[model samples]
Target: MTPFSQNMVSVSLWITVVMLFGSLCDGGKILVVPVEGSHWVNMDILIKALHGQGHSIDVIRTFNSWFVKENSTYYNSITILNTSGMDEEFVEDMLFKMIDYERGKGQMNAIQLYLHVFKAIHKTHEMICQLITNIFESEDILKTLKEKQYDLMLTDPAWGAGILLAHELKLPMVYNVRWTTTGEGHFDIAPSPMSYIPVTGSGNTDKMNFFQRVKNAFSYLLMDIQNSRFNLPLYQSFCDKYFHPRVHYYELLQGADIWLMRVDFVFEFPRPTMPNIIYIGGFQCKPAKALPQDLEDFMQSSGEHGVIIMSLGTFISDLPDDFTAEIAAAFAQLPQKVIWRYTGKRPSTLGNNTLLVDWMPQNDLLGHPKTKAFIAHGGTNGVQEALYHGIPVVGIPFFFDQYDNLLRLQERGGAKILSIATLNKNTLHAAIQEVINEPSYRLSMQRLSHLHRDKPIKPLDSALFWIEFVMRHKGAAHLRTESYKLPWYSYYSVDVAVTLFAVILIFILSIFLAVRYLCVKCCSRKRKTE
Candidate 1:
């Protein structure tokens, strides 16, 4: 080739490389404040995706975090020493109590249960107060964080600490959330009519009878009262202290630029949603990889009978001895092989067919062809995975939001609910049998899987694009609504309604007065002529 042609080819290759690198990432700096446990699990997925795209991420965590690691390849950690929220011991104790209440073994009544939950949630907020106080009080941490100059805040607003920091930094905020500090994420950003939209923990579907609607309204009211009384006050104090008095914490939360909701309309009830709210449900799910040698062999051993998997998610692996025994007895009767994720002692009736492990590849097993059913605790991650893989569920919800999650599946004819309170060997076996033998359950779930998967782009890729969209544009402000800035009266249009009513009344009265004056004038003219 000629010398000019050779030089031109080299220049073109160099330009192509530069464009590829730019497409991968602009290296935008992101500050991530995530919640612990399952919340952290999903957040980690997003962090890894961002890191792959060549963005810089810094995570804010407690010094002794339960799930978040201090050392990682993808992100840096900002550790707040010796302070934490969502105490495990505290939460687990309450979980067991709620289980007991459902079982009828406890003297705790409904009011008592409500109070117990309220107290636990309040205590969590108090710890949140201490955590944020530590950050705001420390001059060195504050000064250094300020110097870093992050582009945006990505947080799980399940706690309000992230909200405060985003505002403190004056950076745009995005939420990787299903719930916020006070309630469900949708209620914060969207209009939720109690008549149709069931409140969390109500265990009612979108379509409700009169009594169910009443129950839904009551549940929503209870949450509102609990949050306003317990959750909001603790954070509101900080907003009052650190921000302008007029700036409420709720406003800061609702004013976020993007809400990357961890739920989708397929699983979630249909409701009005906002433009900035993006659904990325089941983003963590993928096609199953090869199982480990031992697990693979066990999976194959199940043969035509297939296998059933049970997991209670990240926390609460141990149940009462009787409860474990009941499940064990039920599993022993099954022709299918059982893999149960349990960290507790072996139950006396644990059968040859049953295998208990401290951990299992939950998603992989769910995707496996030999897998027939999932015995789940109704956690969002587990449920979403089951949906993605078309696994029918026999849901055994232990406590708090589990019933709500499972209800969605049950309503869709894809799952059955077996409460821990009434769970025994017979009930457990029957539930398992019902899901496995029932063709409708599997078919229902498979339909949902198709719906969830039939999208223009993968959920994770969509999430990445939106996150980068915020970074590229600085914030998704145009997509966000200004309703958060309005007062309640103005938002509901009460003032407008009252003004229109008054104007109509005045117009009617003016017409009446004109008619009366004309009648009197004609009568006086007739009397003068007489």
Candidate 2:
């Protein structure tokens, strides 16, 4: 055989050998407790990927879950009965109230909105606590879960239920985390400086003026207050009731074996982070596939103008009638075709150029060659996907981290942000036009996409490796910091600072008293001489 042909055969044989070895390796059993909505969407992606890797995944969902179905090809699902704390109605109501307030059809100010979001957040956690309570209190459910003998517990710590489950089952915990039970995951585990690392919902960029920094500080304070008021009251007591005295719910979140953060520096401000955080941003994104025949026909018809995609993520579908009309009118004026994921009443102003569907293959549409700018609600998943596809955005953020996600894009010059209160046809149309026409927007996003895609290993592969690493080792405790076990005083060194201050104060006081004593003795001797 020729030398080159022999080498090729050798390489092919090695590849086949590796593939066979990989297939023979047994995958671990993973228990995934995911949050609903966009959170579940990404979690489901991860679950499928894990399943493909030969892992057994058991996902826990409530009976009234809106997104997570009971039946799936990827994983076995465990349904908790009559214990859904939050669902479709809860999120839908919050969206409409905010929408009404923005449209001046309801009573709400910044404070009111802030309060509403926190109270809603707290209630959501409370409901999750109830879910945990139901599980812990139920003998059959808890015992059955214990018997699963899962290798590791993978959960989104935003709800905190999974943390408790992990602890209860004595399983090593890994988090698919961005937000924790209290606030942003980074804030809980990393030394996030408020000066640069803008707090979630602060709407400030990394470069903050004094007032913006003040606002950032206030946002942190608000998070802390909300945590104390809600998280401690609901979770700490539950922990104290079931677990040991010092096992705080928040601490359990910080103590996770690994954190698969859903963002990267390309989409986030550079900040302090921990070793265990594996950034898997845009892991769910992939190249576009062949479109369904009708969608392909529509794409081809758009031709040079390309198409614009609009979606409010999973939580929103309906809008105020006038709001929908304004958006539809704006899309109508565009030269490009519009495909919007809207299930509400079709807007009267919707042009023939626009197509409204119950759902669209969002990642597929974003990755399409003929796609232009994206109109997004600024959810992390959508924003990340848009960035992955090198598409600029016109963002109308609604709640939670949505605005913050868009703010990152806007700061990077890849997106235009519009306030819901100020959004009209003129504004919407102008924003869309600017994003599409301005070459810089696309260029900036392309740069971000390049940076995001430049990684040695794909994000999904990296995530899978880390998750499997945890399972193989039985835990990733070596990578995890022990800082979570430290008390607040010790973590911040407040006690050390106080002790140092006291020592200095005592030394100064002793010196002062000695000087006064010498002065008094000198005066007495001088008086006696006189």
Q: Give me the candidate number with maximum TM-score.
A: 2
Q: For residues 203-275, what per-residue lDDT tens digits would candidate 1 score against the true structure?
A: 8889999999999999888888888876898898898887864579889989889999998999999999999
The regions of model 1 sitting more than 4 angstroms off are: 1-24, 509-530
Candidate 2 residue-wise lDDT at 285:
87
TM-score of each: 0.92, 0.94
Query: Model 1 clash pairs?
Result: 103-421
lDDT of 2 by residue, 1-530 (tens): 99977977886665566456653336888999999888988998899888988999999888888888999988998998978756767887888888888878888886897688777887888788889998999999999988989999999988888988999999998888888887888888888888988988788889999999999999899779878876767888888899964577777778889899999999988888889999998898898788888988988899899999999999887777888999999999999999999999999999999999997888889999999999999999999999999999999998888898998999899999999999999999999999999999999999999999986567887788788888888898889888888988998999999999999999999999999999999999999999
Model 2 segments more than 4 A misplaced: 1-25, 244-246
Model 1, position 360: C-alpha lDDT score? 96
